[model samples]
Target: MIRYVHMYLVAILLVAGISMSFPSGRHSKAEAANDMSVHAKAAILVDAKSGKILFGQNMDESLPVASMSKLMTQYLILEKIQKGDLKWDDVYHADATDQDLSTRPGLGNVPLYQGQSYTVRDLYNAMTLVSANAASRALGRMAGKSDKHFVQMMNDKAKQLGLKHSSFVNTSGLNNQDLAPYQVKGTASDGENKMSARDLALLAYHFIHSFPNEMDIEKKELDQFPVTDSYSIPLRNKNQLLPNGKYPYKGAIGLKTGMNDAAGYGIVALAKRGQRELIAVIIDAKNKKGKRSSKARYMQAQKLLDYGFTHWDYQKISPEKFLPTNQQKIPVENGTKEKAAITSKTTVTELVPKNSHSIKAKLTLMPKFLTDQKKRELPSTYQPYGLIEVGASRVIPSNDRKLTELTLSFRKLLFFMLISVIPHF
Candidate 1:
């Protein structure tokens, strides 16, 4: 009797430990991320491929994103180009409005004269490489056929992309009041483009995945845009993390940056080291004294990227490795065969801790497959009859790998039941 009681107590403790180790529900939110000191008003880090947010702080608060709004214009341009509705060589004639805006000091513009014609490629380079306000507005007008229609397109595309907390007021991201006569109508005259940090990360993820080649233009250290036949303005990429920039990071690639009175300083940064790619977004960054600093956004991004690369890794786990042999098959009721095999349909890849292997698989059968379900005829071979939730330690959540080829069997069912009853033990 004493031995039996001791065995029961041991089993209880083991199961309790397992339950405590892995919590219920999806991947943990920002509150659960590891502690880190970040000075930005909002920031987030996400896995590029899986779209899993690894860390976040006030990430959902909508705030002005300034010139980062050009990313939307860029996306629309690439989208139209991909559909063949637009071409890089297409010419756009500058009107008085564009020429006037291009010369506005402190607005990040290049020289342009009314009635001058420039190719779509030159304007795009200026917009992306140097955050040129007039260039972005020109691309928007060219893509949507009208600036008003283009602003609508930007908001519409934001919805389609699942940017829940984003809204656009202009193609250039400048405050609406700054646009003056060219301000997009039907919006608050003082409003600027706004997006949560999480939304920016999501936007960058889609941008890079949809048009990976855009990185080529983004990484360029220097380029020139012609304001006249013989005179051109030098365009320099401000992303300091680039290899040729002031604070060059080895793997940093092209993304986007933004700044304004309302937005302070922010950047959407991407980097690839080996097989892992990460997206980091920092917004409204300030210096130690809480004043806006041109370099603070990049430093915040560096911290995020370093933390992500140092602590996490991309891993591909085979189904066989996590699914124990005993749980591979389950019993089906009133089926042609007494037993059925439940196998993973594909390998699961996710972000997990570096140099660690502690993945656990939890199998949940459909309600109909429960052992106590009323006898009902089941197909001999049913695809996706169950799901396997795989997690690595407490970091990851159920990736929901489908389990296929389920049938019914007595002996294997008995073994499955025995293990299910004492799964951890």
Candidate 2:
């Protein structure tokens, strides 16, 4: 009987151990840091939904982005698509300038024969999936009359998106040549493209969120171009983490991969598991001392993803609870409703940093509302105001002594009743 009891105890202990292996909304940071020390000069993992940086190393430092500049190119092209200025079926003819920009030696190319016409969809696929420089230049030329104008659009969009540390020079990240003395306006760093890991993550987040349908283009492991002729230029996606049977990480979708001698190796990888999605960026990962190879960027990204998943979780907190309740609603007289709910624009999800228990949020209201001379300002003191109709007169309590005496008497009666009831319990 004792032997049977011991066996039962052992079985129970084993089951308990297995259950303990599964996490109950908790994570460990030290374990993640130890696992992520292998590669990557700079890496950042962010919560895609909240734009919260979960983990980072050298994230703010700007670095050459190489073919990753194509991400911005993709953004601009997609922006045109969204705005109805461009379409997937639009045919773009590759001019000599486009061919020259794309066909430079040592650059990824779709090998577009000069004067070859391809649809916007084809160029977009090549630009994003194959990291084709020629495809990027073609798309740029199609979007704006000149590559220079397209580059300007990229910078303008970056500024609008609040990417403070990012800039673009060429459509394809070709090294800028010294223009003649009359044309040189800025240093190479001034014109040459660069972005911090944080900004790159933001750009990737925008792409993933804005153009979710475009993700279908990134899934093709192999694609052949020039549908008319039997001559097919086969291309493989450089982003290895996409959901392709091989190297599948649950809900792993695409992003982009980039590499050049100057830029080293960069990748912006996105993954979704259920409602939680994450974006990881790695920049300048090439070890100059030959300590590590080009694959370091990918490995670093994977490590960051693993760390983020293991150590952090998206916790949704109420904005009203954290933010001051003063400006939660804005009174608008002319709108469909008397008052418009001006809740926080973003969901208040705390990307709980590793080993951290709580997070604090600070809220700021727009100054125009507070400083407007024409509008009646809401009271600074918190007053209980039941819902009121638009253009209705605000209830201002009369300063009569009789009302005040009556309110005090009611409060005393309620207090005595509460005190009287406590003894019976």
The numbered model that scores best in lDDT is 1
How well is each residue in 396-419 modelled by candidate 2, as lDDT tens digits? 112211110100001111211112
Q: Distance from true position, residue 371, model 1, in Å?
A: 25
Q: What TM-score, computed on C-alpha atoms, does each candidate reach?
A: 0.78, 0.66
Quantify all predictions' global Cα lDDT against the true fold: 0.69, 0.59
lDDT of 2 at 48: 80
lDDT measured at residue 132 in model 2 versus the true structure, 0 to 100? 83
Q: What are the RMSD figures for all models against the true structure? A: 10.6, 17.6
What is the TM-score (0 to 1) of candidate 1? 0.78
Q: How many clashes in candidate 2?
A: 0
